[model samples]
Target: MERIPILRMGKFLLITIQVDMHDTTALALQDDLMAKIARSGARGVLIDISALDVVDSYIGRMIADISMMSKLLHARTVLVGMRPAVAITLVELGLSLRGVKTALDVEKGMELLAAALEDGDAADQD
Candidate 1:
């Protein structure tokens, strides 16, 4: 079983998907990520998909599920570095990723996640 590494960056988890993952690999990633979030008490998840050229419906749904699951576990999920072609493909397939946030790249993704975490922290303080 191939496993993706989950790196901890302060209160965030950084995941870079560099391969065109198989379904099983995707499933494993979902599981591993959830475990990492719980174990690390991460406040956010940043997934970099810049290297991927394909965004099939299955992959799109997996991303959505990962985001929702992360939210349920008290973490924000942000997808970053999506290519234009892949974005168009996802749109044409009608997967809006309704609840998932996105960024243009890793740096912006970190900024976005930081802002979101700040907002969350502020709300919790209230």
Candidate 2:
């Protein structure tokens, strides 16, 4: 079992989850992350998946669930740093992450998240 590390970056929470390419662990991690996101009241979430070599259907569903949970918590979720191979695998498997947002790196993800938050704030002000 590996620990899921969560860090606060600006208004977003960056979560580094370690999965053993297993669905059980990934689902557990997703639940834990959702709980943390709700508790922390983060404006956005950045999930770093650079360490994962492969992603399966269950894990893909978990990722999608996390994205939905983030929106329910009033926070957006952005998957960051996905390996090219893993991305290709997911795409080939027809595991479409339709409503989820993704970025090539954490920095870009954070920038996008910040901009989204800013736009949301500006809209709210009007």
Candidate 3:
């Protein structure tokens, strides 16, 4: 069984999807990511899909599910590197991916996560 690599960077988990998404792989990723977030105490998740040129509805839903699950686990999710057609497909499928933050690239995504984490810390101190 092939698994997607999830890298832990400081308080963030970075995942770069570089292969075609399958049902089993997507499920595994979701479970693995949730466990990592819990065990690593990660504050944020950055998913880079720059290599993926197409995104079906299933993939879209999986992305949304991952984001929602991470949120429930107390981690913010930022999806980056989305292609134009992939974005259109997501909208066409009505998977609005509500509550999921997005960025044009990995750098911006990291920045977004950092700012959000900082804000969260400030709120915690309040």
lDDT of each: 0.93, 0.84, 0.93
Tell me which of candidates 1 and 2 scores higher on lDDT: 1
Q: What are the clashing pairs of model 1? A: none
lDDT of 1 by residue, 21-115 (tens): 99999999999999999999999999999999998988899999999999999999999999999998888889888988999999999999999
List, residue by residue over 1-126, the lDDT tens digit for candidate 3.
779999999999999999997789988999999999999999999999999998887888899899999999999999999999888888887877787789999999999999999999999999
Compute the lDDT of residue 95 as modeled in candidate 3: 76
lDDT of each residue in 11-115, candidate 2, tens digit only: 788977565655666767777778887788888999888887877888788889899988988999999988889888999999978999999898899988999
The TM-score between candidate 3 and the true structure equals 0.96
What's the true lDDT of residue 64 in model 1? Answer: 96
TM-score of each predicted structure versus truth: 0.97, 0.90, 0.96
In Å, residue 88's CA in model 3 sits off its true spot by 1.7
